[model samples]
Target chain A: MIILIHGLMLIIIGIWAMLTRKNLIRIIIGFAIVDTGINLVLVAIGYIKGKTAPIINDAVSTAQGAAAGMQAVDKVVDPVPSALVLTAIVIGLAVTALMLAYAIRMHKTGRSLNIDDFEEQKW
Target chain B: MIETILTIVLAIISLMAAVYAVLTKKTLNAIIASGIISLLASIMFLLVSAPDVAMTEAAIGSGLTTVVFLYALKHIKDRRSTHDD
Candidate 1:
């Protein structure tokens, strides 16, 4: 419950940052915040009370894990979210790098990082 | 009780950093603050029982991303300085 609220708060703050900031770097920062927030929310959703890590270790079960089988599943937390988050984290890094590269190019072409200066098409 | 306290403290740290990163006037400060936010988030991931995710967040989200941003910033500054000279 508390985890959900915290995750949601982070998401809202990140969105606000993205919506209000004009600097390209700041916008990228906001995008990272939002990315982290979503990852947090996903992990929070996967939490189950009193369960251990989703590993087949001896600490989780007494019957050597593989032999424990059904008993192991009941004691461990869900592995799905952790697996998914691994991929998400790497993708987030790639996206952030791409965005920063774009910002560098924008600065090169426009001589500014304010983002508002990039508007070549006028109303 | 202790877990709850830890979670609350971490959440406050992360959200504060996020807000500061957004609202700060200096671009560099904003970038650093955002990095701090990611650092705290990795800690939170550990508390939530996702050590693998925490490791990824710490390395890629907090560490690699900040370095990349710094490199870009340095590149821009150098180009601008050369142009001025």
Candidate 2:
């Protein structure tokens, strides 16, 4: 679908930013964008057209409470991807925090935010 | 019909914000733009019928992430100013 394509485009843009940006914080921002793009792609791929979300609410479950489980099977989109995306979001936040911490340390030692300033790691 | 239009609009805005965040010169502007990207993405998630993901993205991606970035920026700026003085 269009959202899938959009997610791919976002991923490409994020990678471009990550590779081209000179600032450490900007690179981390690029990483966050990439994370969002991946989450979008996963959720989009799991989406079933014309289906509602995977929730067994009154809409999905009719008067027959016993058959509600069966009814929801066909009515809802895949829930696994949504669940995966949730976990991915948390992981992305942790990664971003760790990267920012590293950035802070790097700035502290080097006294510069530019990527070009630190020549110690360059090969 | 309306849903399709909404999706398209959201997608366009999200893309433009992402580009601005990446290309913007000001770190603060880039940070805010990225937050906008996250907010728009949460909206798209709602359009796609993933409310849980949408909620999580709105809370963590747009809210917590922005706060973290701003705090980090403030920390860096404060350190720089102190070092100067």
Candidate 3:
């Protein structure tokens, strides 16, 4: 239920951002929003029911009496999404930086940031 | 149960901010609106038990990104007319 709402909202925002926003910067921001929404959805998907952290430690082993400790620790939320989100974050940063750099360069060359202003490449 | 409600509320806020970001005529306003959307989304991430994602969203989504956008905005003059040929 929670995942559905978050996922749906993410899709809607991504679509809206892609549709509107004339300025290149706004469009880029929209992309970022879409990126964030997707990340949230991914994290939500990995959440488990009443799970503990995936760490296996001496304290937990002693508390759970060693027999059920292994099973208990194994019930932790899936770490895949967490790993993926970390990668996604780095990628997002790289892309944002590249896009901003491009925006800067475009502004320098054409003296404008409006999407419609750059027609020089059309020909 | 409560988590679902919170998610719905955050989703609504994010969508509203997204709409405002898209609808605003001024570029700077649009950027700020987008920032709000990111900020809300970060909080939503926290509620969902994604502290790592929440931190990233809070830092990159709202912090560095906004600063970069504003810096870029500062370098360029505002072109009021979108239809200028």
Candidate 4:
């Protein structure tokens, strides 16, 4: 239940950020919000009740007489999302840095931050 | 049921922030409002068990992005002029 609420909240925030902010930087911030929301939803989907970390140990197999050891391994949380999130984080950083750098260059060339001021490109 | 209600409430709050950010005239205010939107989203991510994402969102999305935007803001002049119509 809590998970569902969290997911819904994330979606709402992301959509909102994407729609309304006018400044380029604000728009980028909106994209980040959307990214975070999506990551949240992905993690929520992977969650399991009463799950343990997925790890393999041969000694545990001998101690638990085989059956319990296999069961323990089966109960672990999914590792795929964890791996994906690491990749996403690095990507997010790179994109944000690039966006900020672009914003800086735009400021230098145009001398104005307003989106409307950049209309020279439209013609 | 409780979760549904919470979801609805958060949705409403986020929507309001979005609308406000859009309607606001000042670019700086809009940027600040967008940061609020990112912060809320990060919290939602944490609640959903994506702590790694939440950490990145909090640090890069809300923190570094805000700083960079402010720096850019400092370099550029606002379009509105005191003497203009």
lDDT tens digits, residues B22-76, model 2? Answer: 8899999989988988998898888788999999999999999998999899989
TM-score of each: 0.94, 0.96, 0.81, 0.64
The prediction achieving the highest TM-score against the true structure is 2
> What clash pairs does model 3 have?
none
Across residues A12-50, which tens digit of lDDT does each residue of candidate 1 receive? 888898898888888888888889888999998888877
DockQ of each: 0.77, 0.78, 0.45, 0.25
Q: By the DockQ metric, which is better: model 1 or model 2?
A: 2
Model 3, A1-123: lDDT tens per residue? Answer: 465466667667766877665667877877877777778778778877666444544533545556756665566667688779867966886798689789878877776677889987776
lDDT string for model 4 (B1-85, tens) is 6645764566567656656765677767866776776676566555544566667777866776667667666655443232122
> What's the lDDT for all of these models?
0.84, 0.91, 0.73, 0.63
Model 4, A1-123: lDDT tens digits are: 554455556567657655755577666666755565566567667767555444434532434656766666656666677568757856876787688778767766775455778986886
Q: Where in model 2 is the C-alpha error above 4 Å?
A: A63-66
Interface RMSD against the true structure, candidate 2: 0.8
In candidate 3, stretches whose alpha carbon ends up further than 4 angstroms from where it belongs are A52-69, B78-85
True C-alpha contacts between chains kept, each model in order = 0.80, 0.61, 0.51, 0.25
- Candidate that would win on lDDT: 2
Model 3 chain A lowest lDDT segment of ten: A52-61
